[model samples]
Every structure is written in structure tokens, then in C-alpha cells.
Target: MRHSDVLVVGAGMAGLMAAVTAAKSGASVSVLSEGAGVISIGSGAVDFLGYVNGKKITDNPFNHLSELGEMHPYNIIGAENIKNAFASLVEISNANGYEIKMNEEGLNHTAISIAGTTKPTYICSESNNASRILKAKKILFAGVEYLKDSQPALAVKQAKQYKIFADAEINSALLKSPFGKTHRVLNCLDLARYVDKEEGFNWLKSELSKAAAGYDAVIIPPICGTINYTKHFKELQNLGFILVEAVSIPPGVGGYRLRHALINEAKKLNVKFIENCNVQRAVIENGKCKSVIALHNNIAGALETEYTADNFIIATGGIIGNGIASTPDKVYETIFNITIDSPVSVEERSDKNVFGSHLFARFGVKVNSKLQALDSKGSPLYDNVFFAGNTIAGYDFPTEKSGYGVACSTGYTAALSALASK
Candidate 1:
């Protein structure tokens, strides 16, 4: 049996944030996850409502919160809490030596995407800013020998189409893969790990130093060091070259770095992480959650373990994350077996266009302003059970580009509410 003041059932952005926030509030926190969350597969930049009604948002995203539905996670968390949450995230990232910069005017800043398009994002790493990339007098787009996914030419083409770096001379160069002759094919994660080491850093420095002399900034694949990217970024800049990481493909190295940094900060605050543990069910007693049972498989067989906590948070994510399971007839929350707050019929959810709005996108447990899970009658289900992130109803993450912002804000609010509960 394991005991904690707060038990977070997912290790994604929301869960990790909740753990850190609760721990900072002087609670003993433990996080359990079956695998790494969507952060690793996401763009490292934090997007806060890039598009509203098919229109691009260039100003402060918070100003458009009123446009969101009443049940949207941001509305539930409120603007003040969302602002504080971003402040906390910035503080944490800065303390870890990675400076996440936002516009002083509080507007969304443009960032270069993997496809070379300019996308709006709220908070971005200092090295990944499109505004900085545009300011360079001359730009060099460098590609690794065997890493074929990132196309320098396409990136340049897209940048020209978007009028980004229009004033700068853009050049492309193909450099030796960091893996050398040992590995014919290089994965982005492997490249990131290699760059994170001292030997690999020296090799990269040697290679880039050869081609980086004339250019004001070097645009390369997001292969900066996995865990030590800030150090690498600073050291590379000290070599008289501004480093810019191109938007990454799936399993993005930048996203992995962000996730790693957050987890590292959480660990520093004594948040316990239990990996590969699939929480199966919650033990509820008299309208309160007392414990959760998790199952793990080893060489021998399946082992079940119980974790008891004064408060529990379900930040398990949406359908894509397997937080909620769906069928032809109904949808259900994976652990608690709660009926999802969605239209009951499948016929009503069917959409002809694949890219059109998905009925499942809006499927999640309903919650009140306190972040407490609510029943059909809008009554609290469990006094100690709270929900955050994609687990809560409302908001379309993909179309709105509000995933990270909602997760961060709601995660912070959930922690604060749980802490205030008796």
C-alpha cells in the first residue's frame, strides 16, 4: 500500500502540473501513468487559442475567453487562475534554465512550424521563436544527412510563402549526421540524446562551426539536447551563432525536452512518479474516493497495488489518450466507470466528414468551477475526486489550439481546489 496526500492518475501536462502545484502547496503527491503523455508528440510551444471561428488570433488569447462555451475548461478555471498558471509555468521553466518567452503585449507570438507555416503560440522556448528567426540578417537552414523527415527546401519555401524571413537571405546546407557511419538512419530522439552528451555536443559544434560562420542564425531540426537543451542552446549561442529549432514532427524532440524539464522540476519538489502502472479502478466510500487500484505486469504475472490518498485527480486525457473509452452506444470514463457527459446516441454523433467536428472530441466528465466531478443533476460525485485537462467536458483542442493552455490552467486550479478541501 502506498499513501500520499494527492494521487494524480496521469503523467501528461495536466497531471504533472497538478502534482507540482499540489507539492508546492506542501502536499505529498504521487503520479502514476502507463506511459508518457501527449507532450512528447506535441509541438513544444504552448498554444492559447490560435483560431476562433476560422480567424487567426494575433492578440492576447485571454481576451477571447468570452467566446468559449460556458462549460469550457478555461471558463471553469477563470481568467485570473489561467494567468497565474502561466506565470507559475514560466517561473518554473526559467528556474530550470529554459526561458519561455511571450510577447510583452500579451499577444500570441508567431512560431515556425515543421511545415514552414507560421502558427500562433502563447509561450515558446527562446530558441524556437519565429520573431527572432525573422530578425536575423541571414539565415541558414541545415539538414542532417540521413534524417530525411526534415526538408530544408520545403521549410524555406513555406517561409517565403508566409513572408517570414523575407528580408533575410535564406540558405540551405546538408551536414553530416551526428550518428556518423555507425548508424545509417537517425531518429530524432536518438539525435537529441546524442546531442545531450558532451562528446556529441563537441561533434555538433565542430560541424556547425564549419558552416555557421557567415549566417546570423542557423535553423536546424529540433535535435537540441533532450534534457539539457538550455545548456546546449546557450553554449551554441556563445559560439557566435543563434540557434533555431525547426518545428518537429511527431514525437518532437522539443516537446520531449519540455516534458522532461517539467518532470525534473516536479521531482525536485519530491513528487513521486510510478511509471507503467495502469490504474484500473477507484475505491469509493460514502461519496469520497479513498484509494485507487493499479495493475502492473512483470515477468511472473499481473500484480495489483492500491494507492491511498486524501485527494485524487483524474487528468487521464481524452479519447485519443484512452482516458475515456467509447463504443457504438455509449462512452465511459476508464477508471471510475462514470458515464461521459455526452449525447447518449451514436447516431446523433455521426459526422460525414472525417475532418469535421468529432462528437467524441467533446466527450468527458462534467465538472463545476471547483473542478469537482459532477453527476447528471450537477451534483458533486466525489468530494475528494477532481478532474482536469482533457478529462473535463467542452472545448475542441485541435480546432481551437487551446490544449496546453487549458491543461495548464485547469491543472493549477484543480490543485488549488484540492488543497483547499477538507
Candidate 2:
């Protein structure tokens, strides 16, 4: 059997954070996952808290914790831990040459989405912050013909509707394809990688300079070199226009950069990842998790293998990521086989409204302040196993916009708790 001091399930934001936190704290760490989680496809920003009761929070999010339900992860862990965790994540990113900006007031920063809507984010990468565009007297919406994800005209029309841009001068410009005549559609990741090379950098600077001359700031899809994105953003800003990156949907370049940087740092710490090992069940004994069994196929062929660790962190994502599974009559945690008490019928579980508040959105493995997974009877299921991210839930990330923020904080908290309990 393979072993380590800590075993983190789900190699997404929370899993990676849990593994890194333990390793950095001097624990030998091993991570197992079916595949990398949604970090690469996410908006690549730490959204501490955005909306409460459909109202946008304009000030320090910490001040508004009273509005959140008591069971929310922020309240469970306390505001100070979240702040420290956010700071830790920022420090790690900066050390890896990835710069995320946090303002002094701790208010949410607005960012441009692929659809051209302005949304609140607690902290964002320097390249994607919309403050420059919001302050600019003149703005340009730059789009590339090859990148269908961003439409300059749509952005121009949509972004202006926000009060922040009400008086700003705005226009749209469709630039020529920097990647010569490749008829296939390109996502943000494709263009960002291209900008890593000399040709792509030259094309962007030369073309954008000519197009964005009159505007004080220009918003473009994320095309900064994924590896040296901050340096590229700084170099391009020297061309006179305040360079702002608009985050694209899915296949996200911004998220990919964060994941890339973190994974690189994890590698430096010698964290091990067991690929293709889909964890099916947890081997719990004596009121503690002893090991986990995963099915895998490799040089040894398809078979079941057991992995033991002193502490285990479960970050397997929620319903969206299939960490929680459901059927007509049952709702449950997949690996632990804990049946969740919920509505008996499907209609009672969810609302007909797609974006409307639904009971199922907040369903997850309930945890105590210590972050240990609790059983249906409200007792600790396993002393050594802690749940992080969407796996331990009380709030809905979709409406709260607190996915990565909670994921990071709870993952770090869970890691610390697991180590402390031992």
C-alpha cells in the first residue's frame, strides 16, 4: 500500500490547497483525483462574497458576514481565517510570479465577463481587474475574429449599462487574427499560449496599438502569456493604454494560469499526484478513516489499491462536480455512502427556476467547526477525515460567488485541523 502523512481527494482548488498546506507545514502529502477540478475553467478570481439576497455588496465583504446564514463556511471558520487564507493564497501566487491584487478597503473589484457583464470579485489577477476601465474617460472593446468567445460590440453595449461606466466613452474594435489564418475556433487558452511567443506578442502590440490609440483603456480577452502573464501585462501597459483582461467562459486562460502556477509550486514542494486513481470508497474503522480504496489501471493492470495516510481531506466537489450524487428518492455523499435526509420527491428538491433559490444547491456533507465530516445523526463520521470545498457545504456557491474563496479557506482549515487532531 502507498502511504503519506496526508491524502487529499479531488485535485481541484481545495484539494490542491489542502495538499500544499499540509506539505508546507512539514507533512508528506499525496493527492488523488479522477481529474483536475474546475480551477482552470473558473473565472480565476477569489470571490469572497458577491451577492446576498440578490443585493450586490459594495464594501468589505467581511463586514457583511452577519447577512450570511450561520452554517455558511465563512461563519463556521470565522472571518479572520478566511482573510489569512486569502492572504496565504495571494502570497503563494506572487511567489510563483503570478500577481493577484487585493485592495486596501477589501471591497469587491468588478471584472468584465465574456458576455460583457460587470460582476463583483473580492480579489483578481492584475491583468483582469476592471478598475482601470471603470475609471477611464475613454474605453475600447477589442475582440479578435478568431476568438468567438468575446464580442466587442456586445461588451460595449452591455458593460455601459452598469452605473460605473455610465459616463465613460466606449467603442468596439474587432482586431485581425494574431494567429494567422487558422480557420478553427480558438479559446482563451489557445491565444494566451500564442502570446507567450515572439510572433504573438508582436502581433498583439502592433495590432492593438493601432486600434486602441484613442482610448484611455482597452478591454480584451485574456491573452497574456500564461506563464509570464503579469510581466506581459506590465510590458503591454507601457504602450499608453491601461490594459484590462476580460475573463472568458470555460476553457479559461486566467484560471489556467492560476492552476499552472500553483501546480508548479506544488511540484517544487514534492507533492505526489496519483492520476487515474478514482477513489470509490473510504475504509473507515474504529471511528476513524484508516485508508481509501481506489480503482486504477496501469502497468499493474486494472485492480483495486488501498492508500493509507495519517490524515485525509475530502474536497471532492459538490453536485456540479459529482461529489454528491442524487436519484429520485436518495441524495447522498458518493464515497462515504452517507445518505442525506432531504425531500422525498424530485420536485420538492429543486425549484423550476434555473437561477432561483433551490434547496438542493446548499446540500453537502455537514461539518463541525473542526471541519470533520459529520454523520446523519450529527456525530463525527471519522476523526481523521475532514471535508473541504463543496464537499462540506452550507452555502450555495452559485448565488454567493464564494466558490474559490470558501474552497481555499476551508481546505487550509481542514488541513490544519487534520494535522492538529493527530
Candidate 3:
């Protein structure tokens, strides 16, 4: 049996945020994770609201929060609370030396996606946000030669298509491979880990210096060190080079940088982490959760582990994160037996376009403003249980680009709410 004041049931952005927030309040916190949450492959950008009414958010993402349905997480927690939560997260990250920058002028910043296209994000890391690319007279788009995940030409072409880069001079280059000939495939994550080492740092510095002699800023894949990324990013800036890292696809190195910073901060406060923990069910009684049961692999078959906590926070992530499992007929929360009926078939639930709105994306355990999980009647199901992140769904995070923003806000509020109950 394991015990803590708060038991967070996911290790993704929401779960980590909840755990860290609770721990900062001087509560015993333990995070049970089946896998490293979506942050494992997410861009470091903390996307808030990017689009509403099928249009780009020109300034404040919150200015359009009212446009979304009331059930949306933003409405539940309110914009002021969300801003406070986001501020808390920035303070935590800055203390850990990982800075999450927001638009100083209350405008949204455009981050370069792995596809070389621009996406509106409310807050992003220094590397992901273009450092005045639109104002630069000369820009360089470069990629690691041996890394197959990115291409300089493709990125340059896609970037130029945007109206912001219309008049700027953009050049493409594939830097020589430092890895040398190897039968193994190298990716952005691999390069990021390599950059964490001293030798790799020397190689990257030398290569960038040669390639960025006459360029104002250089756009490249996410290859900053997995640890101390700010230190590395700052060092590169000292070389008179403004480095903007394009967001990458899965095996996201940028996300790993954020994850490392977050987890490292949590560990300093003594937050325990249970890796590869698959929670099976919740033990609820008298409208309060006492403990959760998980199935663990053993030498024979499987083992059941009971973890008890004063408060339980469900930040399992959405359908993709496995917080909610879906079948052909229904979508259900993995724990607590909360189910949402999906009468439509796979084809019916899907949109005609790949990037269109998804019915399954919005399927999650409903929660109130306090982040407490609710019954179908819109009543709190448990006094001590709360939902955060995609687990309490309303708006489409991927489409809105509000993933981390909502996760951090809700997760922070949930932790505070739980402590208040105590």
C-alpha cells in the first residue's frame, strides 16, 4: 500500500502540473503514470487559445474564450484563474531555469511548426518563437544533414509561404553530419540528447558559427540539450546568433526539455513518481475516494497495488493519452467507471477532413469550476476527486492550440482546490 495527500493519476502535463502544485503547497504528492505523458512528444510551446470561429486569434486568447461553449474548461475555471495558474507555472519554470515566455504586449506569438508553417500560440519558449524573423533582412533555414525528420528546403519553402516572410531573404542549408556514417537512424531527440554532452555542444557551436556568419537568425529543428536548454540557448545567443527552433513531430525534443525541467523541479520538493503504473479502478465509498488499485507486472502474472490518498486528481489526459479508452460504441474514463455514450460509429464520429473537429476529442468526464468530477446530473460525484487537463473536456485542445495552457491552469486550480478541502 502506498499513501500520500494527493495521488495524481497521470504523468502528462496536467498530472505533472497538479503534482507539482500540490507539492509546492507542502502536501505529500505522488504521480502514478502509465507512460511519460504526451509531453514525451509535445513541442515545448505552451499553446493557449490559437483559433476561434475558424479565425486566427489576433491578440489575447482569452478575449475569445467566451466564444467557446460554457462547458469549456476556460469558462469553468474562468480567465482570471487561468491567468493566475499560468503565472504560477512561469514562476516555477523560471526558478528551474526553463523560461516559458508569453507575449509582453498581450498579443499572441507565432511559433514555427515542424511543417514550417506558423501557428498562433499564446506562450512559447524562446527557441520556438521566431526572434523577429519578419524584420530580419537575411535568415537561414538549416537542418542536421543526417537527421531525416527535417529538411531545410521544405521548411524554407513552407515558411516563405506565410505573408510575414514574403519580403525576407531566406536561405536553406543542410549542415554536415557530425554523427558520421552509422546504420542507425538519428532523430531530433537523439540530437537533443547528444547536445546535452560537452562534445556535442562543441560540435553544434562550431557548426552554427560556420553556417550563421551573415544571418540574423537561424531556424533549425529542436536540438537543444534535453537538460539545461536555457543555458544552451543563452550560450548560442552569446555567439551573436538568434536561434529559433522549429517545432518537431513525435519524439519531441523540445517537450522533453520542458519535462526534464518540470520533473527536476518536482524532485527537489520530494514529489514521488510511480513510473509504468496502470491504474485499474478507484475505490469509492460514501462519495469520497479512499484509494486506487493498479495492476503491476510480476514474475508470475500481475500484481495489484493499492495506493491511498486524501485527495485523488485525475489528469489522465484525453482519448489519445489513454485517460479515456474508446470502443466502437462508447468512450469511458479508464478509472472510476465514468462513461460517455458514443452512439456514432468510427466513421460517423470522424470528420470528413483529417484536421476537422472530432467528436471523440471532446469526450471526457465532465467537471465543475472547482475541477471536481461530476455525475451526469452535473453534481460533484466525489468531494475529494478532481479532473484536469484533457480529462475534463469541452473544447478541442489540438485544434485550439490550448493544450498546455488549460492543463496548467486546471491542474493548478485542482491542486489548490484539494488543499482547501483539507
Candidates' lDDT values, in order?
Answer: 0.83, 0.85, 0.85
What is the lDDT, from 0 to 100, of the residue 376 in candidate 3? Answer: 76
Off by over 4 Å in 1: 181-185, 341-356
lDDT of candidate 2 over 297-406, digit per residue (tens): 44366778899999899999888867888899798989988777678888988878898878888888889988987776778888888899988768878788888989
Question: For every candidate structure, what is the RMSD over all alpha carbons to the true structure, in angstroms?
Answer: 2.1, 1.5, 1.5
lDDT of 1 by residue, 1-422 (tens): 99999999998888988989999988999999988889877767888789876678867888888888778888888899999999998888778766787778999877776557777888988778777767788888888877867777777787776555668888788778766654455666777789889988887888889989898888887777877888888888887878877777775777777787788889899999998889999999998999999987442587789999999989999887778888877799999999985577776664677766677788888899989988889899999988988888887787788888888888889999889984
The deviation in Å at residue 159 for candidate 3 is 1.1
lDDT of 3 by residue, 1-422 (tens): 98999999998888888899999989999998889888878887888888885788886777898899898998999988888887877777778777777789877888887668888877778888884576887889998887888888988889888888988899988777778755887788888888888888888889999999999889888887877578888898887867888888888777777787789889998999888768999998887999999876432476788999999999998888888888886778889878865656787766788898887778888888888888878898899999999888687887888888888899898998888887
Clashing pairs in 3: none
Task: Give all TM-scores, in the order shown.
Answer: 0.93, 0.97, 0.97
State which candidate, 1 or 3, has the greater lDDT. 3
What does the lDDT read for residue 7 in candidate 1?
Answer: 91
